[model samples]
Target: MGFCEVVEGRHSIRAFQERDVEDASLEAILRAARRAPSAGNLQAYRVAVARASSVRRLLAQAALDQGFVAQAPVVLVFLADAAASAVKYGRRGETLYATQDATIACAYAQLAAANAGLGSCWIGAFHEDKVRAALGVEEPLRPVALLPLGYPAEVPRMTPRRSLAEMVLDIREDA
Candidate 1:
């Protein structure tokens, strides 16, 4: 699909069918994430793929009891490696750039899933400490998002967006 179509089609899918996502599609999604731009070309982010039922259940619990997290066929945990970024850019990289990298990668993954006719929800409402423990994610790898991906069981209506006049800002000396 074209870029606009893909973007328009993408939505936060909460209900998923029981079927499993294909391996090739999963690989494509990860590859798309890998291609995301990052600060200093560091790509200081890591993704943990949870396919096992037990782990997904734990992750769901960590994500404020969001049952859809466990219902999806795959749960991808996006993490930021602050230490890795700090190795080159120091404090600023650790505090901001690393997190930005992980967020962008997660966005790319979501688009990829949509383009592949899969559904996904970007989950941010989770207890960080609990998520880390559930996924065995250690130091410097801060959890950014919990992405649950699978085939859709329901079609969600498009949520409203702010108009450009309200959201954008234009500043020029000529004004």
Candidate 2:
């Protein structure tokens, strides 16, 4: 599919089939994420892949009772390593760059999943404390997003979106 098709095809899938996602496919998705542009190439983010039943259960709790998280074949937890960038670039790195890096990576992963005929949802409504405990993450590393991946069971209708004219601004001033 073309890029526009892929963009149109991508949706936030909430229901998934029981089919398991292969390791190779998961790696391909990660590769796409790695291709994302990072601030100064620091790439101060890490992703934790969780597929085990027990771990998925805990992740479901971390996601605030979102059972689909447990049902998906793969759950990718995107982490922001503030200290990694802070060490090199200091305070602004911690405040902005790390989160940007993580979010961009997650976006790449989502597009890659769509291209691979897999479905995905970017989850952000979870409790941070629960995610830390469930994933055994140490201090200063924050969970930026939770992504669930698998074959979609239900095809969702397109959600409403604003047009570019409404969302974008042209700053050119007439002389």
TM-scores for candidates 1 onward, in order: 0.97, 0.96
The residue-by-residue lDDT of candidate 2 on 97-168, one tens digit each, is: 999999999999999999999999999999988888888888689999999999999987689999999999
Clashing pairs in 1: none
Candidate topping lDDT = 1
Model 1 Cα RMSD, 1 decimal: 1.0
Report backbone clashes per prediction.
0, 0
| Candidate 2 local Cα displacement, residue 41, angstroms | 0.6
